[model samples]
Target: MPQPSQDDLKEISRDYNRLWQFPNCIGAIDGKHCEIICPAHSGSTYYTYKNYFSVILQGAADANKIFIAIEVGGRGKQSDGGTFHYSVLNKLMESGRFNIPPPDMIPGTTCSLPYVFIGDEAYPMKTNLMRPFPERSLNDERRYFNERLSRARKCKCN
Candidate 1:
């Protein structure tokens, strides 16, 4: 799939805000294991934490639950973050070639925030990406952010 353009990202952010009352969110990202027959001579490369042989399908979806980008065939042993780190999408984002819009003031706050993709703890945090605070160290504010981010990321179906 093609990467979302700057205008597309703005619209996606708007839709996300409408859906979950969260601002500056362009999409939610996640990964799934699609079970498959073990490949000949592949060893355990396709073996997953769930104890199955499979391939990973990593995806990013807009607030409307539409996939904007997807990649398949990653080893099932790889975590979502690992798969993402090696993806073409990640390279584009890291190289500033993805065309994400610049940061702006967060809604209802004076602080400026960059538009970002929401994901779970399995993903890394970056200026253009967000993940929940670690559960063990969460205070009230962190808890609130985690709750909101969780709800937004839950837009995807299992």
Candidate 2:
């Protein structure tokens, strides 16, 4: 693995703390392109999107909306929604090290409580994976979560 630069590490640190700032919160996630020079052998692997040829990097961040960690170099064809199924990120969530926030499906916990992670429509909405309310209301909990997200960041909440 390549080492993160001092500047990169600093930025990551800022975002990581930000995401964790809220109770039961994890980082927000999405993928975008970073242009790469084409390598002849793996020609088609470099696909184009929004007029750029690059690989998509998926990531998660904390409530403060800071970038805590990222999964990079996945083929562009991959969906951000599917990234969580199997990855280092998923493993961390499954393990106890990353405390799950409130509203965890698990009943009865005796301690300070783990933080919860928020997800979006692209992700499978579930008790463990929280998707913000739909643009049009689907249910009370969805509506509540959506409203909460919107209030957090002007155009973006989750």
Candidate 3:
């Protein structure tokens, strides 16, 4: 699948805001383990925490639960963030060529915010990527943010 262009990203963010009431969310990113037979002469490189030989499929789903961008075939030992770090998408973002939107204020708030891709803890937090706070720490505001982000992802899935 082709990566989302700048205009496509804008449309995705709008769709997410309309359907999930989450502002500035262009997509939800995640990684899945796809089971596979270990390849020739490769030892445990494909071995995963799930107790299987696998490859990782890292992808970003738009508001309609459609994959707008996907990267596959990373070794299972790689972390989601690490796989992403080495991806073309990451390179584009790093090169300032991905065309992510400029920072703007969050809806109904005085706080300025940047458009971002939401992901689970396996992904790192950045100006354009968001992840839930560590579970060990609890605060009302942090918990609310995580819950709302999760609900937005769920809305897309359904």
Candidate 4:
């Protein structure tokens, strides 16, 4: 997939805000294990903890549940975080080539937050990536925050 431009990221954030009530969110990211036949001479390389041979398929989708980016061919034994860590998308993001916009104020608010992609705990937390609060001790505000974030992260494609 082609990389989205800065304007495209902004538009995706707007869509998340309008459709999912999640502000400053550019996309939702996740990974899936696609079962595959084991290759010759490959022992456990493709064997996953889920007891299957597969490859990881990582994807990021807009609020409309449209996939804008994908990374495939990761070893099935890897966790979502591991797969993402080695992905081209992560490299672009870390190298400042992803074209994400600078931090800006949310509408009707004075707080300046960086535009971010929402994901589950399997993904690392970064300035441009958001994960739910830990499930440990929870206050009302944190609980609500997790609820909203969970809703925004559910960008599964049909």
Q: Local distance difference test, per candidate? A: 0.90, 0.53, 0.85, 0.90
- The CA root-mean-square deviation of candidate 3, after full C-alpha superposition on the true structure, stands at 1.8
Instruction: Give the runs in model 1 whose Cα sits over 4 Å from its true position.
Output: 156-158
RMSD of each: 2.0, 7.1, 1.8, 2.0
For all predicted structures, in order, the TM-scores are 0.94, 0.58, 0.91, 0.95
Candidate 4: pairs in clash: none
- The runs of at least 3 residues in candidate 3 whose Cα sits more than 4 Å from the true structure, single-residue gaps closed, are 156-158
**Model 3 agreement with the true structure over 1-158: per-residue lDDT tens digits:** 76667788888988888888889898998888999999998899999988989999988888889998888988988999988888877787778788887876777789878889898888888889888999999699999988888977766454
Worst 10 residues of 3 by lDDT: 149-158
Candidates sorted by lDDT, descending order?
4, 1, 3, 2
Off by over 4 Å in 4: 155-158
* 151 Cα displacement, candidate 3 (Å): 1.3
User: What lDDT tens digits, residue by residue, belong to model 4 across residues 1-158?
Assistant: 89999999999999988877889998999999999999889899999999999999999999998998999989989988899889998899899999999998998899999999888988899988888878887899999998889888884332
Please identify model 2 stretches exceeding 4 Å from their true place. Answer: 1-23, 48-51, 95-114, 134-141, 153-158
Q: Which scores higher on TM-score, 2 or 4? A: 4
